[model samples]
Target: MGLGAGRPAATRGVLARVSTAVVVAGVLGLAGACAGGGGGGEGGQGRLAVGLLLPGGGASRFGQFDRPLIEQRVEELCPRCPAVAVAATPDPAVQRQQLESMITRGVDVLIIAAIDPKLLRPSVEAAHRAGIPVVAYDRLAQGPVAGYVTFDGAEVGRLQAEALLQAMAARGKGEQIVMMNGATSDPNAGWFKEGSLAVLKGTAVKIGKSYDTVGWRPENAFVNMRGAVAALGGGSIDGVLAANDSLAGAVISALNATEVRPLPPVTGQDADLAAVQRIVRGEQYMTVYKPFKPAADAAVDMAVALGQGRPVGSIATRTVDSATTEDIPSVLLPSVAVTVGNIKDTVVKDGMYTIDQVCPPRLRSACDKAGLTG
Candidate 1:
């Protein structure tokens, strides 16, 4: 039986009454219907139609963890609910179309990790017009998004920058570093760069070169890193502040291609499996582990609640203002900096990945040295 099937008729009756009151109040337009009357019948007992639009699958996290975690949580919360998920390949146009399709298909709520928030505003507004609440997941999308769930983006950059500075400081002062930021279109990229600059500014580290990677693609990062290497002179760069693990991997690859001896510290986020392996092997410096479970759980909770015409105040503890919207309910989770020292405590302890999963055959020796037992 479905989740709603287990509920007593009396509970359904109460929900029907509340839904009627909500409709009379005319709070959320079509969204109010989604919460109350749109699902099954007069009793408001039916499966929720949820649409999940992820930015891309190139980032291993999106496919390997986030999608599954969110789907599982949504099923647990609303067994009868069906979640339609799609990856946009980092194309804003494709994402917009996907959003439109979901809206037209009558999805009760949308969880979007926008490829380009600005470009998706019109689609988001369209969903709003249709009375479907949108929840901004990970990346904040403009328009009347009902709620947001993500880590403190600026702090992610601050953590990466601070760790890079510390690593570079060990070599001596007056270091020069390259900044490989995410795509310019991503608002989180600007926030990350701002936070990183806030720390990098007034410091001994010289910003030798910076590039806003197009599409946040590894290839773009590789090309940019190569250019930075050429401009700064090979092996002269001190460290790299890569926006995420993918970029960090590309930067590391570029450094390797240049045969830069003693590769400088490179900072990343997402704590991707490869990045974690790089850290164990002493190739990458550190990564910011933004625990996706909490974020995913929050998004699922918010989506289910909003789909059922319930309030999101309890789920969203804070409010954030976007370029197009203000006082948007948000749940910004904290992030942790992961190095070889705490691999066990962070990813392993949290069961994000087993030690064996992270410590592949090639990385076994390094894993053992890092005190990570399989």
Candidate 2:
């Protein structure tokens, strides 16, 4: 089950980076004002206790970028505040428990990338009743969230679908492509799928098979891809719209296993190092790069403001409505489409990943051929 579908939302303010000086002064001033323990909300206690919860951590972009970046920004803004409490898990029940425990510990504000948005509603509500402000990060939680931050998901899907169609141009009309979508439990998955369908519908590309990958797991994607191959036949499938780099790798693996000669182009997101290498090696077509710094900085600003009992409208550039909430203040960031041609210009230039990380020794020749090493 998914949250009730709501109005289409875009992070219309992607170009406007977070104004750190203004946000920092606002937070610190508010904290100082509340130093006498005035009624400034949950953070009126002088120093706020911020808790962060992410869906996944180990080796995922959350750990590689979001976590450290968020922590660093929080420290820079609130040098005297207690260190942000952090937890990561792919399990919704466990995440709920973690959130509840944070609430019990009296954290003033929370930033959560929910594993299951619907299941976390009760926890979010409970926090609301307990006077803690919840900031929805990455995934929107279904409750009274104070602020939201994430990339433009629809743009991500549109970019992937467009890249796929361009790659499959040789097939001309009626190209059969499989849609390897994300977990149905995630709202962003629905948005991505809808965005891609909007583009693919007008084209001659036919969606041969679509799978809502369980838990966004690579192994589940691999199993589904194998099933797709057996059912659709390897020769008939022209492209695969794998939702992220992990799934794209799985899709490519399944195709390799079935020995699909001259493998069809596969689309992915999250410019993971492995995905960049795969793009250079000509195994995958492209991935979406959503710069983590701006998103993290914005999230921290929102968290700090909410923690100190300040209005996030100053920090939020636009508004988004989740299934249960309407006109929630939000910061929507933009994403870039990355391919072999712009690997250096996009990811490397942005410092998301160094050339050595993307190239590695095994991919030296491929990197050279892609003009990344040369």
Candidate 3:
């Protein structure tokens, strides 16, 4: 979908200027709902039953950060809230079954980050039919989603593309970059791709090859990157715009395997620890750092309010439209561009990672050169 063409007027303003102050001010409004004893709920006389579903677990950002953050926020907001039942998988069929199971068990509210939004629509519809509100987390699942929370995908792409352009400029040889995007099933991937194209197309950059990595899998990315190398003749590939850190890692590995000397600049998202280390080692150009705390907090806030049979207007900073729904209440947080230059100021300062974590013993010299050390 185009960014601003059909969005609501209030949403357009948010799209125009999504800032930290605005996010804080908008989210603080949710506190009023919590102050009123978390409103009223139907789960065993005010104990809200929450269901949490993610696309991945174990080492993924959701496992390490989003889940814990959301769980903690739920506890702080509603001490009497039932322990949130959580499930995660990268398979759409499994995720759909999980949501259906939650609906059958009669959870008061569900927070889901769908592995494949389209495939999960029937389940989201089932939840709606069962009078259970589904709060779409990170990824905007189709159907009657009551609320949504995520970073601006377009802004993320813009940042990566702009950074790649700057890095490619240093080469002074060519302006051709391969685009390694996320799965087509992911709507955010399209947003990121469109956003990046908006920037790159306006410039002299020529896209040598572009592939949508299936399932956002590293193996898929490896194959695609290797093919791009073979097709474009490694030396002609000026840069790479891998959608996220996982794919970026694969792209780097493939390039190395192909013996592409003096690696071209690469861009990534999610600010994965390995990606950050790569940046320090001067192997990657930049990664988009989407602050997960605000997103998790907003999702939890929305879930609690929804479970209590309250409207999310108080919590949502803006409204968004999905293919199956329109004007869905949403909290779209801003993101930062992280590179070797501001690792400390962006990710480290936010406590997303400690200096010790990003600067390991083996990376001591690179860390020192990047000014990440004390």
Candidate 4:
């Protein structure tokens, strides 16, 4: 359900004072420092100086949902004290540079989704060494991240596993499926796999083949799916447990290329529009709808709380630890399983997407059949 991003490092208020002359170089195209007053650009002081970094390149859900929703919520909470700076780069090195830049610019708090959680450990340590607060966004940051907000990734896997099981039941296939897990680099991937395996362990189900997706890359999924088909025979693949919507899309594309007309049940997450549409058409069996608003809102609140030197415990409902801390403040958001039956109740209700946008001409009939009326 999530990925990593990066951020740079700089001192807090004290370092900002001496680094005033270097704010330009410090922001790294982000924005100027606010230590000298009126230098923070469109977003300023008394406001929360927050740094937001997303894991992928342009055209990702991080920018679409994580960045704006986070910025919006921050503004709503502290109109005067909310200043969010966003930087997204696909390269982990570039992300590391971004994280350092944010810290150098003196943001009160840093919120990140690591491009590589373990690799970013040094950066997280740098943030802590500088006394900067970090909130692990969506995935664990592995350092001394102060707060965390994310869905139970294990739950994400469990949902997909359960959905795959049900889909298998519908097809009257014996309990066996191929697993399409995410990249091994991401901590969340491991959690999701663990959860899914937990469900499949003693069940009647048997895993035919499984691949740990590289970078959670769709291409990798395609390659893996192709291999699965080659090994098991196209018709033998009873179900696919794709980790996310993107991977699910790849699996479906491969199955289509192989000319398996009526594809097996495939499970996905993120409740992406395409996945939802696939479900409506019966190509994909299910997706996990994580109401992103609440997660975004929680991040916003955590960022603001860190910015204002306020206690984040009020907004946090749970606690989790990474390598550095025993218990970091956290918000473990719930995830809902979205099949053809309830896109309206989850994402549409959460305003993640509009019914009209989702019910395009190609999908209009399917949408109607699924009860997603305009």
TM-score of each: 0.86, 0.88, 0.89, 0.86
Q: Rate the local accuracy (lDDT) of all candidates.
A: 0.78, 0.80, 0.81, 0.75
Model 1: per-residue Cα lDDT at residue 160 = 90
- Candidate 2 versus the native: TM-score? 0.88
Off by over 4 Å in 3: 1-45, 80-83
Per-residue accuracy of model 4 over 240-343 as CA lDDT, tens digit each? 99999999999999999988756999999888878888888889999998878788888766765565556777787877766456678888888999988888
Candidate achieving the largest TM-score: 3
Candidate 3 per-residue C-alpha lDDT over 5-24 given as tens digits, one digit per residue, 9 for 90 to 100: 11111111322242322110
Lowest lDDT sum, 10 consecutive residues, model 3, at 21-30
Q: How close to the true structure is residue 11 of candidate 4, measured as C-alpha lDDT?
A: 19
TM-score of 3: 0.89
lDDT of 2 by residue, 23-118 (tens): 110121223333323112344455566788887777988988888898677666655554544688766666777788878878778888987887
Clashing pairs in 1: 35-308, 35-309
Query: Per-residue lDDT of 1-374 in model 1, one digit per residue for the tens?
Result: 10000111111122233322211100111222333331222322455667788866645678777887876775565454434354444556666666777787787788898877877888899999999999999888888889888888878889999999888887774378999998877778887888899988898778999998887899999999999988898668989999999999999999999888789999999999889999999999999999888888898778777777777787887888887777788888999999889999999999988988988898888888899997
